[model samples]
Target: MASNWLLLRCRCGQSFGARQGTKPSCSRCGESSQITTTAVFTDPNTLTEAVANANLPSEISQQIENKLNEKKRKKLKSRDIANAGTIQRILKQSTDERGVLTLQSLRVCLDIEGVTEPSAEQIIGMAELQGVVHRAGEDEWKWLA
Candidate 1:
């Protein structure tokens, strides 16, 4: 199928996306110079993001990306610790007689704990990686201890 997105770079140093088969004027300068198509995509949201990222100066973009990534890693690390403790407490309260912790049970526990992020699958995967739990069935986990 034909791509619905076009990544256009203009002579004015502005980069943006447009519909395929069409040349859009530079978003930054109205420069009608040759528009170069650098990339194509089928998804409009991703295309929009690509255009925005392209418009950013390379050095500034790199710094912003690095800062965002670092903050995300830190936030996830702290939240994961808090969430792991909450999950373990929930498991003790909610694990089935066979010691299986179902995703549904995890979700309910998360809801009660007022935690909205780090989905149940994410928590389970983190626990599994930390050797705190293991998959016992298609949709359940069993405590390692």
Candidate 2:
């Protein structure tokens, strides 16, 4: 069947299922399959020229600047960086050959004095810092080191 929408594959190698609009998850694994598309120019000069000629509404320009500044401010948070580094270290030390670091293993490695599954965002943040672990086949992780 022809679809105006593109078929998107997640980092985990899962394909999105059919839905009225966008499928929320993979039917086999229930993993999220959000798709993002953008146009990219290979030549820096081309991008610079396009931006220079682009018309911008005053309000939209101000809003865009505000968002960029907000992101910059957030990057200054000490606690977030410290935690990301800590998790990166633990993952490097503890992950096994199968690349399946269970939630239990992670909790012990991090020594979370309290109880709860690690927040998905926190797990993602750690992976972001380490740059070696990414969503792999099915529910497994793909570790580089």
Candidate 3:
């Protein structure tokens, strides 16, 4: 199948994406110059990744890429947890009597559940993204959902 998105580089050196067959003004310079199409991506995530990588300096790209991957994994893992009706249970199991979830509690809960991919920190980050929890103190989160 043909790609749905095109990655383009503007004269001002900004990298951006546009739908195929459409000309988009530079998001940075807004000059609407005839920018060269750099690559094609099949999905918005891949397109976003391309644009982000293009905008980053080569030396630090790997580090930033690692962080981006962690974020992506956390989002995916959180969605899985929510879909499985386990977010509430996990939150309950991982939190204390005061409804505060600690990293250690989450680790033990996940260990019991055999969910070892995301790790405690990633699960906590994901929970924060779902708006179900927020940091209440160092190494602990309070229920928001």
Candidate 4:
């Protein structure tokens, strides 16, 4: 007996390959669709969009942003700034990395000391406001200071 192959549809109206005798939903909108083909793999981008657009908790978004940024570098990538939590984490990390971190140190940690990315200035500003670190002088800072 020939096994029926599985087919899936995306919300975007596109069709993709699925395994035989397997249950899978649309790769785009994530809606379940009728099987029309035997073997097909959904577009990777479509799957990515589907997962990203799904109903997710705010914390999940933060985690995603954190994972992406940490993968990139010591500084926040330009795209990472679009994510508020990533920016917040970067600012917090700036202060936390040192015992007596300073604005300059924050800037250095977030920008100059590593590869340049986005929101360097904004992070520096935010760190100044919320970071436990403080400026000790023209070139110095105290964490408790």
Q: What 10-residue stretch in candidate 3 is worst by lDDT?
A: 78-87
Query: What is the TM-score of each predicted model, taking all chains together?
Result: 0.41, 0.30, 0.41, 0.27
Instruction: Report the C-alpha displacement of residue 70, candidate 4, in angstroms.
Output: 21
Measured by TM-score, how close is model 4 to the native structure? Answer: 0.27
For 35-122, candidate 2 gives per-residue lDDT tens digits of 3222244444554443334323534776899999878657644433345456566665556666665544565665542212345447
lDDT tens readout by residue for model 4, 1-145: 4443334445555555454566767654566654344333344454434434442454477799998888775454554333556555555566544454445545655553343444455555555677644566664455543
Clashing pairs in 1: none
lDDT of 1 by residue, 1-145 (tens): 7668988899877788888866688876876568888998998999989987887695487789999988876776645444556766766765888888988988887777656567778878888999989998899889889
lDDT of each: 0.79, 0.51, 0.80, 0.52
Distance from true position, residue 67, model 4, in Å? 24
lDDT of 3 by residue, 22-128 (tens): 77888878867668899987888899999988988743766888999888777667443433356557768998889889999988887777565567887788889
Give the C-alpha miss distance for residue 4 in model 3, angstroms. Answer: 70
| Cα misplacement distance, residue 47 of candidate 2 (Å) | 74
